[model samples]
Target: MTDAHEDHWAAPVAAAALDARVRVPGSKSITNRAYVLAALAGAPTRVRVPLDSRDTRLMLGALASLGARSEETADGFLVHPLGAGGSSHGEPVEVTLGNAGTVARFTPALAALGDSPVLFDGDEAIRRRPIGPLLTALRRLGVRIDDGAGPGRGAPPFTVHGDGGVRGGTVELDSSASSQFLSALLLAGPAFDRGVTVRLVGDAPPSEPHIAMTLDMLHRFGATVEREGAEFHVAPAKLSCPEYVVEPDLSTAAPFVAAAVAAGGTVRVTGWPSTTTQPGDWLRGFLPALGASVRLDEDGLVVTGGSSIPGVDLDLHEVGELTPVVAALLCFADGPSVISGVAHLRGHETDRITALATELSALGADVAETDDGLRITPAPLHGGVFHTYDDHRLVMAAAVLGLRVPGIYVENPATVGKTFPAFVETWTGMLGTGR
Candidate 1:
């Protein structure tokens, strides 16, 4: 793995067509969700092939602070659940979120189930993300949080004073900024004394698929969740899972699949789930629209480049995490492409819409930022530096651009460690540039 603190990395340009088969690591989403569910499970649960990235590590660390320990196993991990009512210790514990959205939004609810006063803090960028709505919902559900940021200001560097139980009930929340707010409460709902009923108001949250993934995992863990329109009710129950197998991360596979499109070749990602709630699965549908041929066969999901990359109009709200790489691909399109319905990206690891517009524009692509997304037009491109703003997805996007455009230097390439720790090596290996 490249050192995340490295100054810059010269992204490798593909000299020939790619015919690579990529085996991405397990999903960070499933890994952390399993960690939280396992910690809340009634028995020790074995998580097989869980992702071993910085975000997952932060989750493990966070769970440990709440008195749940994970024993590393040959295949994955055996998570020991927290004691009833969580740790009885009255002392304070600290959790470092490290700019991970899952850890930042999900861990607080788990902290509310404990007796300790847990202080939640993370990287400077995390402090700027929108977590206040989730925190406010927690307060409504009877969890006391002190950030000194006042009402409606629920950024990190906050303290959750847990009295060992949550008075979970119906709480209205506006999850427009992030679906994590809803998933956070739902993940910990089974452990709540009265369970939780989340009534989402205002605009429907982007990434409805993520909420479905959460519900699916909850069901696998023996929790009963009922959804009625915009309201979801998670019944309080003892959760248990003997073992859970994680699927390969499709989001991480995006760049490699996109490389086939950019460099005019074929790329196959192994272990592609036949059916999944993963938002990355949306790629199979959208890639073809961008003039790529997609097929899911026994080998895996194969993507073959088309004759000419064409511009597309796409609404990526459900799969907004894909914007970075998709935007990168669009930069090489034959015509103009407009991406819409992902304004929520402003609150991600960075302001992705702005970041995409700025960085891609810097690389000579005609890019414009919209209220919710970006409009990208193809132009004669020459790359100098692509600033990643410490966002992992940006690194993947830059790599795709590098496949077609030479001399693309990625800044802080190590930041890809946020999810795909081996991103640099894997990407270079796909292009036959790795030592």
Candidate 2:
């Protein structure tokens, strides 16, 4: 394996069946939430084992822009809050999200607590992502938000005008576009004068597990949360910052686990939580259904790939982020596979549904774009350049496909820095190709 250049990667071939133990970094979702909650807390908070990546760093930077101070420790971060009624009474702060959906969605509501206007924007991809639901919800809670790009364009390049703080109460919105909308609102809800009561009045949001994760983190920080089905009531409470530990990212572990299943070997990732809200743990069932033997022993969750891969229908609404890895595995399966209930994937880092279809078809696989998901039929796949669309999931999925198909070059391989910065190093090392 060699670097053709900075932007391109000549994906390595597996010398043998992959038999190695790999450890992924901390969870991006958890780390971002910790940063948001810590900044809003009334006291100093210590975030332990937080993921150090582009997305988390962007969240930290956004918090710093809002007058929250953060210090880097060897293990993670030490965050000093700006009290309950935090405000930055200076010039408008510029927040660059860098194509991070979590940073873009969650920060706006938090920024509304500042004394000055906070201008929020990001990369080209971020401009295309939908921030309307969150922005509308913020407005309903009495925060002044101006969509600089204008109405109908429900994306970013906007500003949140803060008059010291917000008057939060009951809010209703349809979060089917993305669950991050609801999570974003709830994270910043506790700091408001009357707190927040959110009601889901339309189609149930996809990725329900992520909302559950948000609620769990809020409760961990001592916020009082009452849930009755689609309604959530959070009383006005002060969060006393406590030391927090982040778990390893199960979403980042998806590709590595997929590699083991596709290449015929056993792979175990350390630090699999015994109990957690991460939806990616659904891999425990998805992997086995795809012809892998999955077990949780002392080492961690281990998966051994079988000789034949099977195709099955799956509804990934609860765990949509795992779709790319599942799509990659199905490319080599014996029959057609249908993945449903993931229409929300259209607004991800890229239009993942179309991107996966385009890239997989580029490799000679028969892929059909469904209304809510994808249908893949096993076909003869040959080496081709897999376009990643600057998405971390696509980068990992293409790399997993490279384990079986030779000469697959991945475009913009460094896009993995958004989440797993050491993805290439860890992936190659697991296949015994390290320096």
List CA RMSD, all candidates: 2.2, 1.9
lDDT of 1 by residue, 162-258 (tens): 8888999999999999999999999999999999999999999999889999999999999999999999999999998999999999998999899
Evaluate model 1: give its TM-score: 0.97
lDDT per residue for candidate 2 within 1-435, as digits (tens), equals: 345545678877787887889899999999999999998888889999999999999988888888887999989999988643344555788898999999999988877887788888889999998888778888889998888545535677888887778899999988988999889888888998999999987888888878999999999999999999999888888897679999999999999888888898888889898788998889987787788999887668888898899888999998999999999989989899999999999999999999999999989999999999999998998998899999999999999889989989999888999999889998888998421
lDDT of each: 0.91, 0.88
Which residue pairs in candidate 2 have backbone atoms (N, alpha carbon, C) closer than 3 angstroms, thus clashing?
none
Error of 1 at 220 (Å): 0.4
| Model 2 poorest 10 in a row by lDDT | 82-91
Backbone clashes, each candidate? 1, 0
